[model samples]
Target: MISRLPGLSLPERVWNTARRWAVAWWRILYLGAVVLVLVLSPSSYGKGTRRALARHLYLDTAPVLLGFTVLAALISLVLTRIVVVTALSYGLSRYALEMVIRVLVLELIPLTAALFVAMRCTIPNGAQLSRLRQAGRFDALRSQGSDPVRIELLPRVIAGVFACVTLAALSCVVALVLAYLGVYGFNMAGLSGYTRMFGQVFSPSVTMVFVLKTLFFSLAVALIPMAAGLYDSGERAQPDSELGGLARMFAVLLLIETASLMGNYY
Candidate 1:
């Protein structure tokens, strides 16, 4: 049941689609910038605001942190064991630690943490925001001389970002520990070699990319769904409305990961 405009050529239609996507991305970036600025402004944090931010941060981060770390530790243990055993069998054990650090800690953990936060916090919050928007809650707040973005949206943004970053960082630590233990068993003798290897693997540029990539993932997870919700026209405020935003967030995550890989290896 889909149809195109009667007079538009294929190239024109394609250009129009691209233009729409570009505008959507611009809006997301602009809104994210506004939120970032608000976060930095001292006035945004009164006693109630701070309390609310803290509550939201706890709700978003604490419950998930332990579970995520446990899961990540288990996965890292398995991967590390496999890599170590395979490398030992092939007489290439020296490369196993580097591979684990690169693959698990540097790449997989961050990406998985971002997705986990998106699913656990941001996407649902975005859907709620969309529902509020559809129900005219934001409009009502504005009419009463309240800035809904600051009072309502900002806390969620902070919570989402914190959750993503905290989960990634904690999971990364777990992965690194599991890797070391898997490779060297429960012994302190390998500590010096392990430190040297870790140092070599995380050179300045690679470390910068890893940090930046995790930050970018956090920001995207916090912002994209909110942008989609804030700008939603009420017509599509069904259960599936958040799906498009989720897809967009995933795409952005993949793009960030790909760029990080290029920076690290290429």
Candidate 2:
């Protein structure tokens, strides 16, 4: 009597366990997404899908890029003025441009842009996916002969990837210009060293890999949260689920970034 009160049967337990694993599998798929991007890099250069991806990326990233540019410009202006004042105080104004480019454009801006999009876009997308799942929309779509994986999920995935890459590129460019002005005061004397450093940091292979990494990061950021969103089945689809989705998304994003950094440096 005690044992039969309402305990889950073996199959029920197995099903529950499988469901947990399915949720975990998305984390794995996030890694797989990165690998897929790397493998598909050659084809993405000029293919129709890649072109569509680029268009979506540009469209989605336009507002964000503009905002980043404004913020970066303001910060650069303040920092440049500060550096110039300090240099005048010490007769060392010549090094300001190099410092700005190296510290801000080459390193900080790209990373900051990626993080901003991750927080602003990817998190909400995940929440929407969760809400859709809770409303049985995904199932309803499936019933109506729609492939959720292809139609609903893939576009966002593509868009996310595109946003990250384009924003990174745009931010990097802005940072470079700001750095040059801050340091060299519109002169070309430092162009050779700047180009040399640019080449060193962005060798062909490195650029290719960086693009691939951003693509993967975007895909994972889009997919994992959405996948986590699907975990709210039946009556469990409450506001709390949104928090869970965000937590899962953050964890997955960190995991992907860590893996990417390790792959690159190690």
Candidate 3:
């Protein structure tokens, strides 16, 4: 009788699974690095590339920004009211404004904006990319002396970044204004106090952490889906791939938020 190969032990199986995960993650990072290099290259900003980028940016940003702004404003208003009322009840009114800024502006808005972009734009774009890959469009473009990534994918990634940053910024501004109104009730007398309070809340270190966290959130929203699509082999349908991308993106966002919270509070 022919000899049979032995089955893997539990440790060997676990090791194999971990190694596969590591290799997959390394490939994703490699793809991100390549995109970053192309983005920074002077030649990547050709006339055609600029036009494509502009189109993608506009499409990704304009339609969703207005809706998200309205929603964010409503949520901010309600949350601000709740916080202000609770602070008054607890005789902690003095700390209400700082709490609002830290919780809503620094934490919630950026995270929400990233998730909004991922749901509205990047996930769908990734699915489309996977479909194109399934149809071998990438290889066809390569055979035509064209770079599919630069021409087709980079713009979506850049636009996703723009959408996340812009949405978060606009929402934060709205939240700050609403917070002031909720706390001080549209009195011009509170303007100086509001400005001072804002400055106090956003110390240099806190500001740095906020900015870095927002940028990382934007990148996670944009890049994870793109990476998933780039590596998807079409063994699964588009919806399944999108679901996996969403899970991965959520995990990364959670990690980023956890780190930001530690940096800010600890």
Task: Evaluate model 2: give its TM-score.
Answer: 0.66
Q: How high is the lDDT of residue 35 in model 1?
A: 99
Give the alpha carbon lDDT tens digit for every residue of 162-194 in model 3.
999999999999998888888778688889988
Error in Å for residue 240 of model 2: 7.7
Clashing pairs in 3: none
> Which has the higher TM-score value, candidate number 1 or candidate number 2?
1
Q: Lowest-lDDT window of 10 residues in candidate 1?
A: 232-241
Instruction: Enumerate clash totals for all models, in the order shown.
Output: 0, 1, 0
lDDT of each: 0.86, 0.62, 0.85
Off by over 4 Å in 1: 1-16, 233-240
Using TM-score as the yardstick, the better of models 2 and 3 is 3
User: Given candidate 1, what's the lDDT at residue 173?
Assistant: 87
Candidate 2 residue spans exceeding 4 A from truth: 1-22, 25-59, 78-99, 201-209, 233-240, 252-266
Off by more than 4 A, model 3:
1-16, 233-240
115 in model 2: Cα distance from truth in Å? 2.2
**Local accuracy of candidate 1 as per-residue lDDT tens digits, 172-257:** 98898888888888999899999999999999999999999999999999999898888843232222246567777889988998
